[model samples]
Every structure is written in structure tokens, then in C-alpha cells.
Target: MKFYFFNAPAPASLEVFRQEYVSQNLKKLRLAAYLAMSVSCGIIMLPLVFPVLNQTRHATFYRGLNISLIFSSALALGFEHVLTKGTRKQPPYWVGQLLCLGFAFAFICSCLGITFIAQSNPKNTLTMYLLGLGTVAFLWDFDYLETLVLVALTSLAFTLVVQLSFLSPEQALLNHCMSFVILVCFYFLSRIMYSYRANHFLQLKEIEEKNLEIQKMSQAKSEILGVVAHDLRSPFNNIEMITSLLQKKNLTPEQEQQYLGLILTSCQTSRNTINELLYLAREEQLEAIPLERLDICELLQQVQQEWQSQLQGSKDLKLLHPPAPLYAQLNKDRFHRIMDNLLSNAVKFTPANGKILIRVREEKKKLQLEVTDEGIGIPERIRPLLFERFSKARRRGLQGEKSTGLGLSICRQLVEQHGGSIDVESEERKGTTFHITLPAVK
Candidate 1:
């Protein structure tokens, strides 16, 4: 709709459409020029072939005109070939315009020349002129203004030629009227053709974009299915095998307890995997999340206390924030989940007595939250995949704890859904710091 115009095309669209139109029509123009050259050659030889046409009063003049047409057509053909050599991309605007105008004028001149030589046969001359005009209109793709200019010039040329050659004033006047009417019809025909081509081009572009989108969706679906199948299979197999072992008569009480423990762990793993898959699915659906203004400093302190107690003094958890309340629009439960995942990772990686810090502040009218830990930092090689689902960077924690490889991914999804960004800074064996930035409530 933006591209559609009642009178003229928009400046940008016009340039693009013009380039395409010109590129496509260039070959046709070249072929037409070649045909013109060949026809002129034949006409030049007509006197020799028929022998009787040589005796006509204007025979010399006709031969001279045909010679000129042949020369001009050959020149045009050579110029076109040289201009278009190795031009695979769209030619420049001026070049295309020059080509179109050059061919147009050449055709017009040839038509008028023929009419002048064949004055005695006025009807046949007029028919040839009309055919030439129709071919010119149909072959070139021109806008309304260009078409109008070309048609007007053609009409004037036709009328002038008829006035100079015809003996009867009445017949000449009739020819002028017919030329005017015919040129008008050609103008509309040319416009209709241009519009059809434009519409067809736009339709092709739209279909291409839709096809690309569909391909991306299909690829993502395949990836999600692959990850789900791979992650779920191991746990399910462990549970099944453990249950079978427990049912065996040779198993002692200790073995039975150990097998039951293995089954329980497998079940827990399966449940965690399912929960993560649900998180990814929910994020993909983009369900609306409710938000409320809350003091972020107070919330961080509460989270610090919760994680600190869980650490039980094996690791020191600290909270640093501004004295004043800094408010932000946040979904409380999702925000809590983000903090829990970060803190859980921090605790799991940080060795005994290593410290964890939760920092909250306002920067440039935005809420900034950072979670830094004195733990083995991520490897440079794996950092790129750290936030990806089913990440290859996933490994056991310092305490030999398991990882679902989905916590950071879910945190990123939740933060982005709240119109925020999450990023990490880390150096191997030094430490890691995560920064979360969100819009602040003033």
C-alpha cells in the first residue's frame, strides 16, 4: 500500500522499479534494434530484387532512407552491446533512460522516413506507421509522463508527415485525427502493462519473504524436538533399568535401597527436564506477564538473606545497594526465578568460603542488577554457548552437583520478556559477573 500511488510512484519505489524494468527490457530493445537493421538491409536490396521498384520517382530517396536506417540501427546495436557488456546487476538510472530514449527515437524516425518515401500508397504507409507505434509502446516499459511525451511526439510527427505528403487536405486531416486517437489508445495500453508488471514483481517479493520465515520456523521446530528427545531419553532409561534391578530376587537390602535412590534421582531429573522444556515452550508462545512496581533494593536484600541461609556459612553471600528505594516494573515471581537461578549457579560453583555478591543500583534512569561470584569462571571457548539451551558448556558444579543447562537460558528469556537484557563477564579461574538491565520506574 505504501508503494501504491494514484498518479506517480513514490521516489524510492520508482527508482527500484525503474531499474528492474530497464534491466528486463534491455535485451528486448537490443533484439528489436537487430531486427530493424536486418529489415533495413532487406529494404535496401528490394530495388535490385524486384528491378521494377527502381523506376519509381522516389526510388533513389527510398534507397537513401533505407541506407540511413541500416546505419543507425547498426550503430544502436553496437552501442547497446558495448553499454551492457558484463552488466549483470541493474544498470544505473541514467544509462537505462538513455537506452530507452535512444531506441524510442530511432523507431520514431524510421517510421516517419518510411511514410515519407511511400507517400503515393498512403493507406499502406499509415498501416506500417501504426504497427511501428504499437511495437514501440508494447516493447518499452515507461511511466505515464514518459509515455505521454513519446506519444505526443509520435502524433505530431505523423500529422506533419501526412500534411506535407498528402495531395487532398481532407484525407490528410482524417489521417491526423486517426493518429491522435490511436496514440491515445496506445498510451493507456502501455500504462496497463506497466502496472501489471509492478504488481507481479511485488507479489514475488512477498512470497519469497514468507518462504524464508517458514523455513526458519521449521528449522527451530526440528531443533526443539531433537533437544527434547536427547535430554529425556537417558533419564527414562535409567529409571526403567533401576526398577527392574529392584525387582530381581538376588538383590540384598542395601542394593535395593541404592537402586530405589537411583530411580528417585532419575525421576527428579526427568521432572526438571520437563519443567525446563515448559519454560522454553511458554517463552516461545510469548504469553503476557503481569508487572508491578517494586523496590528492587529491598527485593535483592531478601534474596540475599534466602541464599545466605541456604549456604549455611559455607559461603558468604552479600548484598550491596543504594540507601534510597529504586523502583522498577517487574513480574515478581519471574524476577524471583531469575535471582534463584543465578544464586543457585553461584553457590554451586563457588568453593567453600568463597564469596557471592548481589549488587543493585540505578544507572542512566535504568535498573541494574549484578550477581558476581568468586568461582571458577566459564571457559572462553564455551562462553558463547553459555546461555543456549542444552548448552555444551554445561558441566558438574564444584560440589559435583548436576546441571539441567537450562537455568541461564530461562533467565535470559524472562529478562527479555520484561524488555530487559542479561549479559555476563567472566575470566577463566578468576570469577564471573552477570549484569541484568531493565527499565526503571521514576
Candidate 2:
């Protein structure tokens, strides 16, 4: 199959997605509540218009009540539709609050007007008005103690109006008590639901803010690493070249050998440090390079040739590969770095006469590579964090080799960049195997 770079758009930021979800949910909930209120009110007030429930009623009062409720319900539906559009510019919070309050007040007024027009027994009329007002107030701002107090006062006023105007003593007292009780229960239930929804929205908002902060910090860190690495490379390159030149100059035979060895070792150490810094810099500045199909067998052979002298000196060194050629789409430079780090690690940690094996194979559309070594395997606790940058998993090699604790991290980054994964299986004093898997090109 042919490989191509597909530049998919970056996913939406967490904050944006979260905000949209919450807005949609709240809009749905409010719309449902408004619809229920409108339908229930309309059904309950039907008797006032039909004249079956009462005959001593004013036509103007009944007409006004019905018209107000119809308009309020229509306005509520319009607001809900506007909310559902998901436009960037939302109506102001105060405007929305006013709209909700206006609808609720109109609904309450309609219930009271209908009650007064239909009933001669003031007990029932006052009960209807108090219950409507209390419900509307609680729904408008359920968590406010002041609103609950207003509901209580309205209930008490209703009781007075019933007793003074038309209710029998016993009936007025009983209806008043029941209305107040109902108001209290509705207020508490509405308050609880409101609190829960508010807290849920707050928690989601906090998480979104944290995610944004983390993304910003990651970007800043990557940029800083890139800058520092770029600045360090030039001086180190000059130093390595100067050291090489000095090593080749004429000198006393005894002194020449000692000086040459010192210069070469210094250059090597500098070169290794430079390589580590470069890897880190690149990781910060770039996403994974797009993969290109190449022969892994050829790449490994070339790497082995580069490190031939070092591998030849170790009598126990063993390199193994499948007889058939293996091909993969990978970033070549990154792949080489990963392999070199693992091989060098094995050589350093393995004792004399201890074997090291580099093995490769294909398994079910995946390419697997394993580097096994009869070396002092990593400690159990240390293994988990082995691939973390600058992790404190330091150990002296058999030959006392120095390390910067960066190789494994670089290896991990490179493997992941190719849409692959790496893992280790090790037993102390037995062996360690670094296993890597990549998607195979069809």
C-alpha cells in the first residue's frame, strides 16, 4: 500500500467541547420544564372558560388570563429555540433571567385571574393563586431563601384572603395549612435539583480550565527545550572537531598515545551528550515525521557495520534476524537511534562471556523487534518508570560506563512516534528483553 501524509484537523479543545455540552443539556432541561408547566396550567384552567365549574365570573378577567398564559408559553418556546441554535453570540444572562421571570409571573397572574373569575367560594380561589405563585417563584430561583420566604408570605396572604372574603371558618383553616405544606415541599425539591445541576456545571468548567493549562505548559516546555538544544549544538560541534585535530598532531611517543586517548574519549563523551540533547530538542519541536517504507534488514546491517569494532570485541555478542527480508514504514534516523541506544545499553550492562541477541520477526500485520541480553536486569520497582525522561534509574555498567539516563526515554519517544509501542520483560540477574511492535505496511 502507498503511504501518504494525512493532515487531519486537531481535535476540539476540552474546554470548548465541555462548554457546548453543558449549554445544550441545560437548554434541554429548561425547555422540558417550561413545556410541562405550560401544558399543566392550560389543562387545569379549562374549567374557568367552560363555565361548568362556576357561573359568577367576569368575562374580561377570564379573557385576559387566557391570553397572557398563551403569550408567555409562546415566548418561552421561542427562547428555547434560540438557545438550541448554538450561535456564538448568546443573549445576555440578565436578558434570559428577565425572560424567564416574565413568563413565570404571567403564568401566576393567569392562574389567579382564572381562580377569581370562576369561584365564589374564596377558599378555593385563594388556594389556586397561592399555589401558582409559590410554584413559579421556586422554579424561577429555587436556591434563594428570599424567594422561598416570598412564597410563604404569599401562602399566608392567600389564607387571609380566603377567610375574610368567602370561606367557612373550618374549610379556610384546613386549606391554608395544606397549601403552605405543599409550598415547602416543592421549594425543597426544586432547590436540591438546582444545586445539583449548578455544582455539576461548575465541576465540568474546572476540569476544562485545568486541561487548557496543561496543554499550554506542554507547549511552552517544548519550545524552551528546542531553543536550549539549538543553542548548545554549535559549541559542542566545534569542541569535537578541535579535539579530533589535536589527537592527530605530532608529539613524544609516550605522551602522544596518552593525549590521543584523552582527546578521543572527551570527544566521544561530548558527542554522546550532544546526541541526547538533540533528541530532546527534536521531540519538543516536532510531531512524529510521516513514515516511509524502508527495508529494516538493510537498516540494521548498516547500523551493525557502524558499530562493528565495538561489537567484535565482545565475544558473546550475537545478532539474530529472520531469514526473510522485513520492511516497515518508519522514520529511519529515529529507528537507528532507538536501536543504537538499546544495543549500547546491552553491551554496557552485560558482563564478559554474557550473550546479547537482536531479534526481529513479523506477526499478524505487526513487525516485532526484541533485544535480549544476559545482563543485570533492571530492578522491579525501577522498571515501571524506566522510559520516563531523567528518571532516577541509574546503575553502573559492568565496565563502569557513564550514562545520562536519557537513552530509554528517547527510544520510547521514537517508537511511539512511529505509531508503535515498546515494553520490557526482565528478571534480575537473568536477562532483559526490550520488545517493540509497529504496524506493518501491507
Candidate 3:
């Protein structure tokens, strides 16, 4: 049963749309109320200019009805004003309904008063009622059912009043038929108004959702740029330092060769970083990485050798792992990124000649790895936020090395995405250790 008479929203969005619809219509409601007030005031002043009321025996009663109409309109306006004074949240649904129905009642009362005064001129009376019906149609928003109720009540009230009070039977019958026809015409008009308003709200809602999605994408772009800039800085700095060292005149052939090798390693690292950034930017959600069952101890040994070579004897890098190979399901590249970030942090903070240890073991179906460095330890206050992006805990290294603070955060994200967890332990000035736990392949 698909009835198009009511332009209703989907059920999931219905409640939200209702609130927004009411909020948006508040100004229109106020304007319609003002128009009702103006009409009432105009009719109230008519007795002063025209002597028609003086000829009527019920002048006092007619005067009273016009005054009551003005009062009701003002009351409705004041109530709406009070409700919408300082808030953006829409009032309850009944509140909007009450305002609409009240204003409709006021408009009908004004029509009745005018009809009574112009009864002697049947043509004028019919014209006044038709205009009133049209005004009700254009002034407010209501779905088909409410409009039907409004039209039915208005027509019946007009028919009963005309037949009982002023007109002869035949004249009243003619008036009744004409008013019903006018109301039926306006019923369709009211539906068009309702449909347009509802459709416009839906368009605006769609635009709003699109704007939110665009904002999220823009934010993601900024984050990727920040990450690329941060990670590339260290390797680029290493290349610059090694190149400067190689340029000095007092160096031995061995020293020059070592410095050139260091520069080459730094360049390779920078290229790897750029490749990783490209892969991340292309895959925003970091879709599943192809995993392999491999010996965890062998991977750690390879990383240890790489770092030992990069350190160039400045730090004593040692590995302590079980003699037997421990296996885990791992994404090789992502696992390398985690180790790189952790070791980079250790090397930066650890003073020259300090000891850095990589410990790996398997216990109770879990593989555990730890990197402990005798560096300037993390402050207690900083430990909690150490893994947060752009953390305030980031500080200069022992040799005044700069930090972007995003490394640890990236490490934690990579570890968690691989079904592993990372934690840190540190004390100011003594040492710091990072621990990682991953499921072991039995």
C-alpha cells in the first residue's frame, strides 16, 4: 500500500526529520500568526468606519467575537515566542500541532464574523469564506489527514451556522455546496505545499550528510601528510649528518667508506618510508595485510642486525632470544614498521655508549618481545599518553634529536591491527622498555 498523499520520511529518519521540520517552520508559524493578528485587528476596526454593525441587533455579540479572535491570535504568538526564545531544539510535536490548529480556529472565527456581517449581501459572504479557505491552505504545513480534518470541520461549521442563523433554507444549501467545493480545491493545494516543504528538507539533509563525509576525508588527508613528514625527517637528517661527516678532510679511507655506507642506508630507509606512506594513503582503512606463518625469532634477528649496522657502534645493540625458533602468523612489512618505530625511539633517547636489548620469548601460547634501552627514561606523567598521536610527552633526545611524537602512536595502531598488543614501562632518568605480546603458532 504505497500512498503518495503524505510525503513521509523513511522510518529510520522519521523522528529526526520531524524535529528539524518543526524547527525550520517556526518562523513561518510566527508569520502566519502575525497575519491572523493583523486580520483580526482590521476586522475589529471595521465597526468604527462602517455603520453596518449599528443596524445589526447583535452588534455587541459580533464585537465580542472579533475581540476574542484578536486575543487568541496574540496568545498563540506569545506562546510560540516564549518557547523559541533562546533554544535551537524544537518544541514537542504537540506544540506545533497546537499552534497550527489554534491559528486555523482563529482564522475560521474571523471568517464567521465577516460572514455574519455580510449576510445581507450573499455574494460578499461567499467571497469572504472562499478567501479564508485559501488562506488556511497556504499559511501552514499539515499532512493529508490533518488537512482533511481541517477542511471537514470548517465546511460543516460554515454550513451549520449559515443554515441555523441568517440564511433561508435554499440560500444556506447553496452556500453549503459552494463552501465544500472551495475546501476540496484547497485540500489539493495544501498537499502540494506539504510535499514541497518535505522534499526540500530531505534535500538539505542529504547535503548536510555529504558535507560531513567531505570533512572526514579532508581530516584523513591531513593525518597522512603529518605522518609522512614526521617519519621522513629522521632518515633525511641521518643522510645529511653522514654526508657532512664524509666531506671532512682528516678522515681515513675506512672512515670515508663507513660514512658513505651510512648515507646509503639512510637513503634506503627514506625510500622505504615513502613506499609505506604511499601504501597507507592508497588504503585508508588499512584493509587486511597478507599474513604468513613464520619464525618470529628469525625476523627479530634480521631486524637486530640491521639496527646494529645503522647504530654504527654508538649504542650496544644485543639480542636475547630462545635457541629454538618461535613461530607466529605475521604480516612481514607491518611487523617491521612496529620494530622500526620502537628501535628508533630507543636510539634517539639512549645516550651514546648506552646498552639496548631486544628480548624475545614464547610463553603459554603467546610470543612476547621487549626492547629495553638505558636511555633518558620517560617521565611518569608522560607514560600514559606516550602512545597517543602528537603526544605532549615527546621531547628532545640525549643529543637533542627532534621528535614528531607520532611514532609510538603508529606502532600501537600497527600492533593492534595485527592482533597484538604493546605496552611501555619507564622511569625518569633510569631506562625505558616497550613490551609486545602476539598470539603464538603452536
> Against the unseen true structure, what C-alpha lDDT does each candidate score?
0.80, 0.66, 0.77
* Candidate 3 lDDT, 148-192, residue by residue in tens: 778777876786667656677787778777777777788878777
- How would you encode candidate 1's per-residue C-alpha lDDT over 168-222 as one tens digit per residue? 7777777777777778777777777777777777677668879998997787677
Which of the predicted structures, 1 or 3, would earn the higher TM-score when compared with the native?
1
Counting clashing residue pairs in each candidate, in order, gives 0, 0, 0
Best by TM-score: 1
lDDT of 2: 0.66
Estimated TM-score for each candidate = 0.64, 0.51, 0.60
Checking candidate 1 for backbone clashes, the offending pairs are none
Q: lDDT by residue for model 2 over 1-442, one digit each (tens)?
A: 1111121112443334334434543464366457745675675577667766444355445555556566667667777568646565665544554555555545555555556544555545555666666566335533244345545555655554455446567776776677677667655555554555445655676788899989977965764465346534544665676566666757567866665676676567667766776668778678648779988877887777766667676636556778777889988888898999998888888887688777888899999889899998989999988887755685668886766667898889889888899999999998899999988875
Which residues of candidate 3, in runs, are more than 4 Å off? 1-4, 11-17, 49-53, 56-61, 86-89, 116-126, 165-177, 208-234, 247-276, 283-442
lDDT of 1 at 387: 89
Q: lDDT, candidate 2, residue 429? A: 94
Model 2, position 75, has a per-residue lDDT of: 67
TM-score of 2: 0.51
